[model samples]
Target: MPHFHFHSVRLVKALLACAMLLASYAGAAEKLANVTILATGGTIAGSGASSTTTVGYTAATVGVERLIAAVPELAKVAQVKGEQVFQIASENMSDAYWLTLAKRVNVLLAQPDVDGIVITHGTDTLEETAYFLNLTVKSKKPVVLVGAMRPGTALSADGPINLYNAVLLAASQDAVGKGVLVAMNDQIHGARDVSKTNTSTPDSFKTPELGMLGYIQGNKPYFYHVSTRKHTADTEFDVSKIDTLPQVDIVYGYANVNPVALNALVAAGAKGIIHAGVGDGSLAAKVTPSLTAARKQGVLIVRASRVGQGIVARNGEANDDELDFVAADTLNPQKARILLMLALTRTSDSKQIQRMFYSY
Candidate 1:
């Protein structure tokens, strides 16, 4: 009888132990994380004539709290905090806004509890903002930027879903050290390559040549690769110390190109200019004199092809050898402008800036 009683006690002890183990497993399985959101005014914050309306819109209409409350499912992924950094329409966004946003991002990434960040931005200049962030923010932590094509009040709008996916990707451990990211249409893309391809389509944001790094599946982010570009919260590209970048302009090129625009920019004190030349970024014969005068005045000039792909040759039939101007290697003219301004922030030396055009 004593032996049987002892066996019963041991069985009870084992059952209690199993219950405790199961409880602990349940707790550990939870993906608890901390994330911060820096909201800038965009379509994500806009509203319409009615609470249920999603079409008609106004900028910076709704606050970050409303955006956060709109999607409660975020709690399942991370403990999120909201900070309204700016409440202006993205269309009104400018370099001042970019510098402000970059500084704020630098501050948030410095916090230890902050695992990631999500920014709501406008669609019009989303590419420019994304590229700026990609080049500046030095943190390796996931920085995801998202926006909506429709008002937050709409019935079939894309903001809620986009914000949800962005938060998920931002909180995921797999997303760290991958540079800044933009998530839209359920796709995750690197900041440098992603651009808006369609205006109003739900699947508008796209990354060309290179595809998305990964995708959000089953409400989770699955990234299979990483970008070779530099990024994160390291504060490598400080904004305050490097202000007053040279005035660089892009001049379009077509048949019968005129030198008037180039001459005007030089007169307007343009420190550098990018000629959107034809074919391999070659300028028309008529524009040669204007380019020469601009270069002679020490206005750094770069020739870039209007063609959608490939690098522009330095020694082309465009008479680049005599001009002493640098030719961009495959950078689109607009991208060339961004790179040029950023490079010029550090140095005005044409040779050093030329190296930047090639590397970045």
Candidate 2:
């Protein structure tokens, strides 16, 4: 009966091992971070006619819940919950939407259970929205923006993998206080520096001059750089009480540009106008008269370069100090418009506005 006792001891040891395995898994599950995905429909939610179709597809066809289901691996990384914030393409993103989104993000980040947030957006205007949130979001919690160049129905769909990496980045403690980030094509970019450079490729978003903040490898984010400019929780811009953003418009500069466009925008009650100047943010002689007139009318004028990568040095091409114009340092025209809108809400003094441009 010694043999029976020996077999029973082995059985008991096996049961104890099983229990330990189960306990370890339970501990890991409990440690998972709680991440909420705020989905604003874009190509990531678009669906084509067939798996091979990429272009000419219907965008915003899928909802947040469906997008979440498409990426089952997201569950392994975090306790992810999806919210259908808006079902329109990012190109249709409006200032009203920005206010609503910023408010909602502020509210959610205030909760104790929320560890981070991931926003699904369209590549077209993703940089603009990311920058806006970078300025407005009050909390230090990680906020990530992600998008796909191809529709989800394509044979080599990239949405699912991109979503997985974004969730991973958001859940990481290292991502906190780094400002809002854009994760696409396995690259992590700070909102202020990144812009969509390509039309249809997955590697569209890039910070060509400053380079990416980091990159995602093996489902983890590794940092090499962080934006030194003020962002998130540090900026003076607040959207909590703001109902509507001020009217800010952009004008392109070219050889012998007509001044009528500048005059028309001022007549339309634009609070701020960004001249997308040519070469070092130069003000053409033809449009200078109109700009001077607009400035006298209490309109804020900012000169931003049309070049993809370069700084619009203050008082370089034009006498910013004398002309009372603000230069957009290292900001593209589209992003310049965003900062000008927020700056107008606080003050219109050219000096103060220029300070905001440099600080943000």
Candidate 3:
């Protein structure tokens, strides 16, 4: 009888310990960060006919709910909710779309229940969208943009792990106030510096010059740096009241380039033009007159480099001061166009815009 009683007591004690452990786990789960994934439809949501198909797949076919379902492990990192913001390939991303996405991000971030946001986007314009949100999102909470080169149906699709890591970043306290970030192929890059470098590789998005913000290892994000440029809550850009963004265009420069494209863009009601000039943002002599003419007509001209990865200095290749132009200062033509669009919304003063170019 005594032996039986002692054994029963041990069993009861073990049961109590297991119940306490379960309760502790429940408490920890309740404390998990609430991350909302605003899916913008990309290769991450793409699907192909066969598991072997990687390149030629229909993108944005998979919905957000299925994407969240595919990655059940997301529950382990954070309490995730998915919202389909847009279902178009990021290459089709427009200014109106930018306004909508930015406003939605602001709205969600304002909610007390929301913790952070992860945007699943197409690789084509992922960097652009990320940069747009980086400038306009009005919160310090982490906003992570993630994409995959291989479609979800591919043999070894990268979307699941990328999505998982993005959620990890979104839920992390370390990611707060880091502006906007892009997580791809296990690397973290600042939105301002990251660009899609390759057309179809998983490791395509890269910050060629300034380097990436950090990297992910063993499903954990490790930070090494953050962007020095003003972003997110620190930016003066606000699209809540604005309906349409000003028309800004990009003009590429090459050897013996003509000014017809420049004149055409200006005539087409371009409020601003980004000259993707060659080598240090140099202007082809033939194009200078047209740019100067457009400048005189109250059109903003920003000289950016076509060389892909270099700073466009104020007086390096062109006399921006004399022409009353704004140098892009490391911003590529595409990104320069985005900044120019937002800058035009505030002030068209070249000096003020010039300061913006430097500041942002």
Candidate 2 weakest lDDT stretch, 10 residues = 255-264
lDDT of each: 0.81, 0.94, 0.93
lDDT of 1 by residue, 149-170 (tens): 8888777888999999999999
For candidate 1, the clash count comes to 10
Error of 1 at 355 (Å): 2.3
User: Cα lDDT of model 1 overall?
Assistant: 0.81
Error of 2 at 339 (Å): 0.6
lDDT of 3 by residue, 1-360 (tens): 999999999999999999999999999999899999999898999999899888888999999999999999999999999999889988899999999999999999999899999999999998899989999999999999999999999988999999999999999999999999999999899999899988887878889899998999986889998888999999999999999999999999999899988999899999999999999999988999999999999999999988888788897888888999999998888999999999999999999999999988
What lDDT tens digits, residue by residue, belong to model 2 across residues 138-254? 999999999999999999888999999999999999999999999999999999999999988788889999989999998789999999999999999999999998899999999
Which pairs of residues have clashing backbones in candidate 1?
53-153, 54-154, 137-232, 138-232, 138-233, 138-234, 139-232, 139-233, 139-234, 311-330
Q: TM-score each candidate.
A: 0.87, 0.94, 0.94
What's each prediction's clash count?
10, 0, 0
